[model samples]
Target: MTGRPGGAGTDIGLISLDEAGARAAARVAPVPGVLELPLVEADGRVLAEAVVARVDLPPFANSAVDGYAVRFADLRPGAETRLPVLGRTAAGDPVGTLGRGAWRIFTGAPVPDGADTVVMQEDVTLSGDEVILPSQSRLGANLRRAGEDVARGQEVLPAGRRLRPRDLGLLAALGLERVRVRHRPRVALFSTGDELTEPGRPLKPAAIYDANRAMLRALLARAGADVVDLGILRDEPTDLERHLREAAGACDLIVTSGGVSVGDADHVKAALSACGSLDLWRVAIKPGKPIAIGEAAGTPFIGLPGNPVAVFVGFVFVAWPLLARLAGATAEAPVVFPAKAGFHHRKKAGRREFLRVTLERRDDGAVIARKHPGEGAASLASLAQSDGLVVLAEELEQLEEGSTVPFLPYAGLLG
Candidate 1:
């Protein structure tokens, strides 16, 4: 297979996944519009600007435990000292100035004036308003200094960062009621295959349920895109062309699975050619070789494979980055970790392969990866049974048992 047919104005050819990704990212712009949302509803939203500290965290120096605040000089080793109880202070309560030879404090309560240290109540004996400090107590052992947790005017969060539940709590601690976040990218999804059927309906002999549409929608939502389902289309050039035009006009990006193959019934290519331009069609990757990329009505269009696993891989390897770039995200390659191979594996030399494998913890605390039983791109169960993908570089054809190989954990991206 090759990339989509080039337009009359420009020449297009098959490119690697990296080059295609760069071109797609360069062609697409970030989603427009920003909205101020309450911190309570801001989870999973990317920040449009940096979050600075409105006030110091903790706000004031308070007691870390229920104890008495006193002058360190009053408690010396082997020296007996008795200080008068200068009243009491509880959380959110104020205690007047600490007179000489007296102490006052409590848990979470502000330290009284002129007191520099706190001694736990368990370490001292109290008898009728008089407190006796142990001779071995250290000076200033339990004081929580003001501005220790967060300083005033500090930049707590930077722009372009996605907010999590914990991040919202941090903003709450800083007393921010609202935040500014980037607009979510609008993604339009559709599928093409006369043999495809929805799950609820009974299937005919040559029909299969359209799983790629649902799967890609979930993945795109996880990547922070506002997905609009364009449903499935028949294998007709006119119908496919109409949907492609509508999707392009309605959404920032258009994604579809199937109908980009070389077979005669595959009308997606012709439809794209009729509408606008299809720039790329194929990539140098296994399982997802028949990928299609182009622009229709100035909206980016990504065509994935028909196989379930291939659709997902293509989404992760292609569509996900495109969506992230459109959402104003600073895209970075996923991190890979080294693991030992539990079994030998073989592949071709020119095409990159992502083998599904289950990683087991060995006795030595190292991870050993074993390939799944079935390697077909249509086997969705194989992905469910595996932990991650063991990437084989284009030049490598064989890997021996116990050889160290780089792998990417599915947990990193999906979780």
Candidate 2:
């Protein structure tokens, strides 16, 4: 990979992926705000404050079945006790007070005072407003206690938590009409290349349709970012500089692909340096070695590789976590699973490798990974057809078949 021209405060040295990520994360600050939004609009937003329970869930003890509430001491394992049915208590109906004889209750109805157990209607025989309790009745049977799901004053959702659909449902169940959440990070994305053409247009012999922009936009949206498509820029430094300036003023972060390489048409690196400080460039990784991290007019700019697969890998390893941090989201380590290598692979030391593979269930019910045929960074079909990527550490030289390796699933990342 080529290096960036030396400038004030620019680290042009080659660094490992971990070092590159750490440096990039340290350069940006989290966006500040605690906006109060309705629960309906809070889905996919990170919580700025911890949500504490205001009232006990199921505030009162209720019956979990449509049955009669009774005292456990009134019946034994073998003996039958007859109790007169007082008033029927359906859901939302008031059961004034329970008489010593009995009380009728339906599902979700509050258990009557002085009742300690519930017996399903099918377990007893009813005759003329009188029911015989089975001797096998147990105490607290079919009864849901107050605060079983949540307690008043308990923290239900912590800060930095990304709210999911089920999380919003839980908040609604708690009667929370509104919640405080971190502001979404505005991301402006663009592409740059003379040989690139937009989809749905006729492609010349030397030009190919742009795929990195769409792919990265989808990935950013999936990460809960407010994406602004800035379209494509030519191989001119002045044109790239204009877009960089606009993006810097309008967005919290700027991401672009296809202009950070060593070719003469690759003017994004120079444009960024001319606009602001280019902090780091060129990470030591396969398929994505030509990465760039810079700040243009105080806005963080990430220049990803031109290849489609490389752009995706770079986003997963670098941009995703940085965007989460900028959006005030809690960071989580990538999910990895142990898989046995189905083929022998060789790699150089001191550089992480992400090998694409398809996972299949073997006859013994074990997951066996099969490596894809093409390993080129521009092969989007291979990445789409594969299930996950196997991560090889920087130290190992050779990996034989049956060797245990860590694999990361693409489905998990998107989710």
Candidate 3:
């Protein structure tokens, strides 16, 4: 037996949320190798190879402003110097050298030879076939040097980085048609509960739709896993055994929502223990206290709680990072920033808590977290209505209004 004293009798002990996360991270081995993808298709893929740039960004000395390109030495002090506008130079148009004169140049246009600076159109008055240059315009003013944005041979995208849309665009600009990225991990996902039914089916008199299945599947897929949904299962010993074995064989990671708690109907705990190794952890966190981690049929399994919010907590805090690691990515923790509390809050001292909160940007630029009135762990609506969560440490019994606390925004977690 392994668990906390109040829960299912188990040899495993109650661990803090931090310990649970670190433990989950320690258990995963990143999948090896890579696959080449076209630049447009590489968005959201983890880079397996460092991308070195072949050429300097911009690739030429260009104008940073839509004005005139000229020689800095031609202007005299305290007086405006007039020069002929020999020709117009637009972006991608290269002009001949400027000899004691000016050329009308649009933004990004290459600066002609002998031209040391650019002057904004607003700084000088344009006369017919000529422009007035200010004597005060300094050398190199408004000039965009070649390779200013990126230098050739620089590491543009480092290895183990998850590529974003901007990365894709940068790689495209660098003329890399293909990029090598790690293959997504295949995950087996399911939910276990005798009282649950699938949505869109006629509801049984006493059963609820298995929301965890859909939710977990979505979370896994969004985290870059190839999801193999195993659907809902009963607490029956034989059924759990069969599915657990099958999932272990087919998936790189296995996840189940329900049947890992202290209840007598916890067939997931029993099945995992009998099939292989199991450590049912009692994590010291609210909404989700009972969680399990182990191996079955040589595959890793993470068992989360049945409550909708608990499932969310476990997936966000553990399973997502586990998947990222297995997919050859460095799983960075979600950023928690200091935010002022708009209302007073209190909780028991033994466990950590995450409360749903809406953030308001104060006039002074301080972020304020307004907690949801309903604090129920099972209140899924609270999670839906709030923008982020205000994290309370285990020893924090109460937080007063206007006090600083850490807030984890949903935008960072959902991605």
Candidate 4:
């Protein structure tokens, strides 16, 4: 028997976090639907197909600065040359060929034909009807060429890419009004245990407000999933079975918190068995171990541990990859950077651990990861007060002060 909180047995060998993530990703299929959305509403959605450039970026040759456009041959070598200023051209104005003269051009204005160089206004002296250019100006300097940024008919974006704000700007520059994107995965979410009470309700003896459902809803929303909140479910076996059946029928995936352990009150496994199938995975990870991965009525299901911090870790590390694949998006890995440990501590062997830590730049020009004072998995304040997590691999038995460790910032994980 394993010495976990619920006294469950680890008959299945402990799965590595990476292997568990891959298994979870392989269990579900992408949601089978697509929709065309305007560019304004397509941010955070996944592209359904590859997009090709319809027109060249910039679409024409223009000036890179507010300056004078002149031909390279007009400048004299080793001496300053004066050229007559013919006319002024602003952005979107018509251009005329240069005839042994220079044209005053503003930023983004088209360069005149037969002109091959632009001299910045600050670099040249402006005399009446003439501009004095320096003796050393390279041909084609400060002039933007057409089709330099992106050529027409080139594939600008690939399939399964998540659209960002800047991606919308790119598509807009290509003159695309709408794009086809994968529909958001519909997720049915709920919390278990008779002791869970909704927030703002009267708290009875031995009951806490249901924080997991609300937190999970927001997390799923941020991951681009349409959530179907099924509220808190009691421990009754028959009621749990009914709810799972309904959720499986209506949603692409089912997510639940708690009730997956071996205790008598924990009934998620039995409920899933009645409706479909369940596999209890004891992953070799700290704070979260007993994860339920299965399918209910042919729809995928993921049961996370009840602890708040455990839920956060399981969702970020395990469930997110599955969600990403189901949404038809390219998998994004969290960036990990190195930092020195500020404190020394021994950890349990054979399990990966993530400690909430705040970073400080030392006088020696090294960043140090300081572990939070509280190490409990239920400590929400520790999560809020800390910057991110410092990961310790399963092989690491102890961490020494001043040792380099990998740090994962919240910005990198959440974004």
Enumerate clash totals for all models, in the order shown.
4, 0, 6, 0
The parts of candidate 1 lying over 4 Å away from their true place are 1-14, 77-87, 99-107, 119-142
| Total clashes in model 3, counting residue pairs 3 or more apart in sequence or in different chains | 6
lDDT of each: 0.83, 0.87, 0.84, 0.89
TM-score quality measure for candidate 4? 0.95
Ranking by TM-score: 4, 3, 2, 1
Q: Point out the higher-scoring one by TM-score: 1 or 4.
A: 4
- Residue-level lDDT of model 2, residues 215-291, one tens digit each, is 99899998989999988889999889888998999999999998899987789999999898887778867768888
RMSD of 4: 3.7
Comparing 2 with 3 on TM-score, the higher-scoring candidate is: 3
Please write out the lDDT profile of model 4 over residues 1-415, one tens digit for every residue.
0123212332237777888888788888889989999999999999999999988888988999999999999889889999999888999998777889898999999988888899999899988988999988889989998888999999999999999999999999989999999999999999999999999999999999998888899889888899999999999989999999999999999999999877899998899999988765578888888788888999899999888888888988989888999999998889999999999977666678899999999898899999999898888878889999999877666688888889999878875
Query: Once superposed on the true structure, which residue ranges of model 3 sit more than 4 Å away at CA?
Result: 1-12, 361-366
Tens-digit per-residue lDDT, 57-130, candidate 3: 97889999999998888887778999998778899876668887898889988899888899999999988888
lDDT of 2 at 305: 91
Question: Which pairs clash (backbone N, Cα, C closer than 3 Å) in model 2?
Answer: none
Question: Which of the two candidates, 2 or 4, achieves a greater lDDT against the reference?
Answer: 4
Scored by lDDT, model 3 comes in at: 0.84
What is the alpha-carbon lDDT for the whole of candidate 4? 0.89
* Candidate 4 clashes between residue pairs 3 or more apart in a chain or in different chains: none
